[model samples]
Target: MSLECVHMPISPKNLLVVSHRYRSFQKDPIDLVSPYFDNVYVLVRFNKFADVSKYVHIPALQPFISSSKIDYTNKPLNLEVYKTSMFNLPLDSQYKKLGKLHLSVVEKIIGENNLNFDLIHSHFIWSAGYVGAKLKEKYNVPFIVTAHGYDVYDLPFKDDEWRSKIEYVLNSADAIITVSNSNRECIKKLDVKTPVTVIPNGYRQDLFYPSDTFKCRKSLDLPIDKKIILSVGNLEELKGHKYLIEAMDYLLRIRKDTICFIIGEGKLESRLNKQIKLAGLEKNVKLVGGKPHNEIPLWMNACDVFVLPSLKESFGVVQVEAMACGKPVVATRNGGSEEIIVSKDYGLICDPARPKELAENISLSLDKSWDSKKIDSYVSQFSLSVICNRILDIYDSVLSN
Candidate 1:
């Protein structure tokens, strides 16, 4: 198909994009949208030692210039500034002025770039959206914001300051986009005036799919004899890894051959380890540090079931990935899970924060003979091409207006 034939009418002017996760470039919607723009200016914070992964290293598409460099080194100077720039920090630091320093630096970067942006696109409400609201004020540019999880669900709304700041961004932005219907409802409760659009995060179908299970397992040096149950997410309390571990322990008790592998890492790793040790699952549960995002499909395909037990999520992008790999999902009935995991068909949705329920549902999933076709059908809804087209349509509607 010709490029012109497929693309909706969109003029590439200037799009200043900001996101927290460009490090995982493949999952970034802005990366998918870059082809439609004349210039895509991205602003992202990257850990000092983390390599510039797939998304940032892609050979530039000329005439569609894009560049960004966020200093997130572990040095004391950068660390001090980062601490002050943090948004929606815990109650102890809620009154702190971290967001102020963060915004100042962000504003300076916007100014220094001399970017004559027609609009600002911020990912999430607290950090990027908050910064975008300021850019809208200073430059009189039409700004749009996208809300993803923690920005809305994790923030303490009872606090007047956090509530006021988030509401300010929501009300001030020219447009708002969320990844799921659930997120839209959550935003409306915050009294956001900006019209909210539901645009899901997408996967690179070309990169992720149901692959040779044995080959994937062999490549990872995992035992071919075990029935793998996999969970992918940062090791965090909210992610509900503890619940999955509990479920896995129960499964192992019943079927001693089952193994659970967790991918991704965070501060919660230690706590999770303790849980696994306490449960006597140290031999069966493996906490593998984060693999490159592109390599996730191999792990997904190698597993019999994919679990995302997040107590809360604006949208669980990992669930979609599991479906894409033709594996059934068992997730919690938290934020976005309801919007995506319909019911007994696509995957199981257990009560949020309940380990026993999670174990029961997981057992059911393991017993059932899942239809691979159904799995593919479920994930296809959020394919990158479909999501990119939806976002392009949104941009088209905005620019056309």
Candidate 2:
């Protein structure tokens, strides 16, 4: 549905969004949702003591350091973002205490600015959702939390203590919004009484859309003759980049014409590089570090097929972005990819972490003739306007009652 068809209330409402970062998947929805609200107050939480660059001396790890700095020059007009930091030592044991500490920081910001909102919409469970839950108690506002990826599927199930903490944050919210049915099922495992809704994450249509393959390849200086496979995501363990590298090894043995480009930076870069070297895929698989978010579309358009070899995902929005660019996807049956590539017509889905199966599917995707327009048309339902409208409907329903 178009944004024009979305119902708007007579009186304007203000929204407060508490999130981990103001970029990519988190920021896209807020940008789309901003036009519907009078004011969108975004509170971004950062750890002051988490700067690894200051302590670590390794050169390879230098690029993966977490930065609290955010460029606000391009933010939306109605969106007023407040970034706050807390001094929390980087330790796994210290995680549960972060919620209260984060809440304290948010309370200070809200008090100093005298910020008020009709409702609280927070992303993630710990820290942001916890802060939103506490703020709801103080202000008596409807609180909503979106549980994305690791926060839902991985964190809570680690132990009993964490499970209780995650459950408390979820139960406190007026409503819970998870990205996929896979995530919704994870929430159901917790047995929380709060109403849960499945709202898949969306891609920016303006940034990622159908483009000429030859032009995109020429612009990016990529080889026009080679069959290019692209994967854009952090080079982390959960992302399953190593498996993709393995799959590339298998593909190279059959066809020397294919080359895979892995984008994004992380702690696993050195390890993945070693694996690539050992497998003798040095010429085929290129670990082209993180590219700017805007430049991703160019890479997407230049590739023959997009591959997502994630071990687990609440929602793989990158797959949607690739489909938006009119490219066929070869993804593993990670929780989210199966939902997006429901039919083989859209793309191919293989078992996660299996090099042989991933290799077979990647080969099939490369050989198959896919309709670019059909792929683009199929992904339009995941546009920002459609996602934001559904979210707005949830906001209206929560506030009206």
- Which prediction has the highest lDDT against the true structure? 2
Candidate 1, 1-401: lDDT as tens digits: 11111465466567777655443432245656666776777665332222322344222211111222232221122111111122332343643353454567677776765666777778877667777888889888778888877677646365777788788888988778888787777777786677988887777687667788899999989998887899998777788888888878767667777888999766677788888898888889999866766689999999989999998887888888888889989988887887888757888987887878888888788899998777887788788878878877777776666
CA error at residue 337 for candidate 2, angstroms: 0.7
Question: Each model's TM-score?
Answer: 0.85, 0.94
Highest TM-score: give the candidate number. Answer: 2
Where does model 2 exceed 4 Å of error?
1-5, 54-73
For candidate 1, the 10 contiguous residues with the lowest summed lDDT are: 75-84
Where is model 1 more than 4 Å wrong at Cα?
1-5, 25-27, 46-96
lDDT over C-alpha atoms for residue 46 of model 2: 78
Q: Give the TM-score of candidate 1.
A: 0.85
